[model samples]
Target: MTTPGHLYLVPAPLDFGCAVQSPLTDALPDATLRAAAGITHWICENAKSARAYLKRIDAIHPLATTIQAQNIVELPREVHKKGDHHGGFDARPLLAAALQGHDVGLLSEAGMPAVADPGSSVVRAAHDLGLAVKPLVGPVSLLLALAASGLNGQNFAFVGYLPQDATERTDRIRALESIALRTGQTQLFIETPYRNAALLQALVASLQPNARLSVSWGLTLPDGRTRSADVKTWKRTPAGPDNQTPAVFAIGR
Candidate 1:
């Protein structure tokens, strides 16, 4: 009786039994449980995660095993390039998935999609197609870093990943530093895992000495560390947690 065309935009939480590594399996429990022992459509941010998830969860038959988790990597790939991440640019998969009349759930690799993730495209497409996009509440990295930063959370902007190039990144930081100083709004963004040190160095060089910087790494996970210190002190002596992948960074005036 339920329309198969309906789409559910689910959000996977940020933790795994408070475990060491929160893999896709750890995140899928809520979605699978909510699928009501039956499913037919799921669109995952990463193909590997979806496959690994299916292996662990024992899905029911017909409405259960028939549930297919399609890897929507290429959908995001159409807009995956750097600098063009403002989003709302692509809608092919969202359209295709909706046209198929499958109640699709758009999931990100880690945190809630569309905030700073790639699922926004699918969400927008669903809206255009007049399909219901149900959101399953879950963890978000932006809010996670903001709450821990000890900065004024009343206002903030999540800039996602910062520029990788030195000159452009520095210029962008200069502009954001001025805004942070004037508006007192926290400026939060992330860099590639390995480039943590470099991004921190850029912050030190670009921001004012008196400006406050909150560096949160490995949020909501084992070895999680967060530090809010003056830019001057943080720069003179930079030291904090070490992470290999999946990191977050935030800086405020």
Candidate 2:
């Protein structure tokens, strides 16, 4: 019987969409880079973007081979929208290379795969198939934001994204705020880059004056900023454009 290959959960840098490229060595350890470079087969959120990331790493450490020689299987756009657990997604076929004793890597466009990112189905499938899953260390924007927020890090939850509708968004923010105040659990969520300012405004309007709100944008980038303040303070302060940079929003007492 062929020994099943291991699944490497490789992490990409948090500066994915930023204008400048972050140094790979600074963000990723050499072991993670080597592990990523060694794997040629990948289940990725976007094949083109994955190839580009691999090429960037290859420029520094040199991949086992060229990017063209790598085998990449992209997760469907629907998976990205509805998440990987939308049912009917059999990730076993994607791991066929692994069955043949060849290692496979799961990659996200930014940050770690399978965590608040499309590719959880693949990780679930790996567990079901008894494949050894190994996650390499790298930058995670959520943890970074939580640590920087100075909130209740001991008890926090990543609430994902908030509702888009005005009423629903306000309701959701208020609901999360209630939980934060009662349990001291830091509530974390994100918004589409273009909607950052709008969400910030809504947050300021919905949360109580004393409730603290933290907004982190362009994490791991040179101009990245993480600011935490009470809702009242935020309302008085002039709001700056996030410019569609990826951001994390957190609320706590």
Best by lDDT: 2
Off by over 4 Å in 2: 85-88
| True lDDT of residue 35, candidate 1 | 66
The TM-score obtained by model 1 is 0.80
* Per-model TM against the reference: 0.80, 0.96
Which pairs clash inside model 2?
A: none
| Ten residues in sequence with the least summed lDDT for candidate 1 | 58-67
Kindly list the per-residue Cα lDDT of model 2 for residues 1-253, writing each as its tens digit: 9998999999999877777777888789998998899998999988889999998889778898789999999987888878865556888889999989989999998999987788888988999999999999998989999999999999999988899999998999999999999999999998778888898888888889999999888888878889998888888994643766899999999
For residue 29, model 1's alpha carbon misses the true position, in angstroms, by 7.9
Clash list (residue pairs), candidate 1: 4-101, 5-101, 6-103, 39-67, 40-67, 60-64, 60-65
Candidate number of the best TM-score: 2
